[model samples]
Target chain A: MRITQGAFSFLPDLTDEQISRQVQYCLGKGWAVNIEFTDDPHPRNNFWEMWGLPMFDLRDAAGVMMELNECRKVYGDRYIRMSAFDSSHGWESLRLSFIVNRPKDEPGFRLERHEVDGRNIRYTTTSYAVDRPEGQRYR
Target chain B: MDLDVVPMTGNVNLREELEAVGIEEILTQLDRELIGLKPVKTRIREIASLLLIERIRKRMGLTSEVPTLHMSFTGNPGTGKTTVALRIASILHRLGFVRRGQVVSVTRDELVGQYIGHTAPKTKEILKKAMGGVLFIDEAYYLHRPDNERDYGQEAIEILLQVMESQREDLVVILAGYGDRMEKFFGSNPGFRSRIAHHIDFPDYADDELLAIAELMLGDMNYRFSAAAREAFVRYITLRKAQPLFSNARSIRNALDRMRLRQASRLVADLDRVLSAEDIMSLEASDVLASRVFANGSSPANYG
Candidate 1:
């Protein structure tokens, strides 16, 4: 099963048009659109490598799409997401984030369990995709 | 010299009264009113201070994201969980976090529906009423019954999680129940656990604190225990603390009510005599003993 972590994971995958519309919505709200990709999709992995600087001056959705396309060209098999950063007074975090790309063959995760004292068991989940080095994760 | 009639001064500090009431005042009130649970009070203060700083940061145009306000209050019944939740609502309101400082308290009966299609609307309706304020769910562990497969409580919990996440800005949820049961409930629902930003444990009050709480309750009613009656109350509370259904303050309130009833009857019995003010206001040892006799099926000699 695909690692459903980001927003709109329960919904169907967004088409190019839907992604453009979402980018437009974020740009309309004066938020900067940014692209990030990661081979490790751990739920606690908050720091995904940024494709480039946030498109702060780009007011058009086309500019965001161009950048997203460039990011996909290099890390097509990695998890790529579009995030809108709100630098307003009350919010400096991502206002909106959703997965826009994922590898075709998701290796999923392995749940490792260690039996502790008595009935206690500690469990750790590790993504199998992380076993591979960067740029060769999918292959 | 009527001991029952305590005089109240009309003098008020103008500066203190005119000062903007803030979270500090609410915390002070909470500390003053609550009998014990020092840890709970400290945690609440920490949360309030963080919220205050967040509000200031927002005004300064600094980085400010409202942290999750949902909390878990684990303790026994009548330990003032609901009372603390009410005060927390006031604190959040005074800090400009919530619109209204009201608390809508509910149990599983109100949230879980009887039929399959009934839970969502029922829970949503309660959430709507609790919006712009605090939603206090007492005995929240009852909302999830894994033993019963047909139960609709899980549905209510799901709806609650959804609202707690989506309407976090407008609503604050406090889940309260027995400590172990609440721990189990959180273990079963990781989503619920993740949303709870604060975990406040309301410890059972000590014997001295319970005694103080009893005095406070009686004082509010203009009632006082005679010297011997006070000793009897301490003994009675110590004994009652070990019994079943020993709700800390609630049991004390019940015991006090029974004593008052006994005192009223005792006073009526001596109505022919001109009773002194103290006699009418005071609870004698006999009255306290009689209340205990009525509560436990034991003989009065056993109390003696």
Candidate 2:
């Protein structure tokens, strides 16, 4: 999906690196995003080109957000944000943004714990609010 | 084979009962997806618990006051209030709080009926439809306005109030609409306000959550987006974030449909001959974002 200031024009041939860079650029510029996706309204057969592109239909805003989720899962480390107007409410236009939050560890990593008490100073609690050593929860 | 056979003693066929009433099925379906509304989920669970307890009390033949069935669901459109109402109906039936588990959903027009004497039977008919389960009234605020001279919305409200009071044990009534509007409607009618005890608010889905929803929808349809396409879509979304008319999941679905449709149409354009599976399967990025579609559509430059 390619976005422009004027109208809905798509550059279908953009690559992963290009998309990633674009996302980075948009974030750097502090712009809002309207996520448009291929599965919205209806599914497209030509997903390769249509999968995660922005569109210019005020009616398709929901569809775009749905697609952005897919993009995050697929692209791994890439993300973007943009700003636009919503015509649904007939109200003043506002700016919105989208940014992807990814996990730090892709697979899994091991961490060493201190058993200073000798009898083992480890306890487990299901309540996430419980106080514990920073890295002890996963164990 | 061992000659000793063990007999099952407990009368509760939990799995069978669940299967018989479609509880497990609806649960599975609903559990598979829930977007950003944790408070709503907790309330639903609590209501479900209340219904379960009510059922147990009934089974023991204890003469206790019937559990209150009134609720006020506050949220914007596209919020899952309607969906949650339907599920609540099912859960009620499976737990034996109601007999049929049917949901008779209506708006003001449908409930108020047409003429003076006509309102009674019309409201009755709707109640009959909702008998044994839930009566979900969408945009219920419209019912409070007796001020509208020609409108029968007031009559419908009166009828609904009566039905809600009388049918407390048999049917569950849910009045849903915009939060602020509902509040005003309640303020206008003390009787209606007193009956409703539980209120749940559904919040709007954030951008990341919306993105996740889009992905889920596409993945379910077997569509995979390329990196460029995803970024492009996100870029568009970010540009529109501050706009008041933010599209929810429903809007996102519509956009995806149009994008895919445009892509599919491209393959058929050049074909004077039959199109192949391969040709039909792939959508080029340009095909999805055709300039013609957005020619008169929204743009950042003209958005202000």
Candidate 3:
């Protein structure tokens, strides 16, 4: 998967060794990680220049799932964010959905949307109870 | 394009040639070489190792692979920060981190073009030079401002952020400068801060370390120091040790060059004497006195 992830923090707060190890660890588990520049904020100062590399941007969704399985073996239950395409009518249109993995809820999280690529996207933004089908573990 | 397939079984020591050439020899020969910063070295090594692993796993069909990584270096002047960065580009190429590993270093002034609407192409031109390898920005702190500055360092920063994520598979970005100055630099722009996951620090060299480094410079040039000359050099260094502008290896070098010229002048009348290597190598009091080692402006900060 061509995976990308990003957020903000002063680059110096995290040593180069720490970040390289994390990138290595992520790659070792089958995730392609790119630490590139991003316009994120500093930890202490809300207004610092975005000087460091951002996060991972995954290209293929199904490929990401395979890697996510591998990731589970290493990261255990640690929260991971996933983005995948939702297509209809044989690739007529496509959009992406975001989800978090939980032990007891749905086997995986899926979001329904009017249009998958942009704003009309819906998500399970928080962890809460939902009604399940007859044999569902936790819907 | 590949019709013939061959089977391989043995491990090859890929860097035997580089190792044979000698790290010190290569360092000395380079147009610019910053010396002595172990922490920065170790960090670059870590990044190189990670890049190597990614390549191996991808070949075996076991990983999602990307081409290059983005990293930042933080340190003061004369800390050998830029020198290490260039070495990193070389090592990364050897290890297959980036395809070319050509390091294109620039400062904010080079990146942020003057006037409105001109900065994007300028930044892109720099990136073009840096394509297939590393783009190293010295004094990256200057790129971020409070939005009223005439320099388009911020616009360049934003455009760079988008390009970094888009073209990350082939390019690496390294932002470098003094530690405290960088903190203040980052404090000015939030958009420029978020993407960096790693930071490396280059600390200042100790006095004795700098002196030893100076001695090494002379040794490399096939010259040796006499007892008196060595003492005089050390005493001279001690006298200026507290000066805010004293250079590390570089200042010591300027001193030696001046001494060499002084010795040449003294030996002009004795050219027929057939001097031994020792006689020529051992620097004397006259050389030091005539040299500008005692000059007022012989410091690292004084140069650049």
Computed on C-alphas against the true complex, the DockQ of each candidate is 0.01, 0.01, 0.02
Candidate 1, residue B85: the lDDT equals: 89
- The numbered model that scores best in TM-score is 1
| Candidate 3 Cα deviation (angstroms), residue B52 | 3.1
- Score chain A of each prediction against the true chain A by TM-score and list the results: 0.94, 0.27, 0.23
Q: Tens digit of lDDT per residue, candidate 2, span B118-214? A: 7765665566456556889999988766577667777777877876787676567999998899889888888988888788898887878777777
Off by over 4 Å in 1: A1-139, B1-21, B293-304
Q: Judged by TM-score relative to the true structure, which candidate is superior, 1 or 3? A: 1
Ranking by TM-score: 1, 2, 3
Say which prediction, candidate 2 or candidate 3, comes out ahead on DockQ.
3
Off by over 4 Å in 2: A1-139, B1-28, B61-63, B146-150, B272-304
What iRMS does model 2 reach?
A: 16.8
Q: Give lDDT tens digits, candidate 1, residues B141-218.
A: 898888997799989988889778876766889999999998898899899999999988989999999999999999
- After the best TM-score superposition of candidate 3, give how far the Cα of residue B246 lies from its true spot, in angstroms: 2.6
Provide the lDDT at B21 for model 3: 26
- Give lDDT per model, in order: 0.81, 0.58, 0.57
Residue B84, candidate 1: Cα error in Å is: 0.5
TM-score of chain A of 2: 0.27
User: Each prediction's TM-score against the native?
Assistant: 0.63, 0.57, 0.56
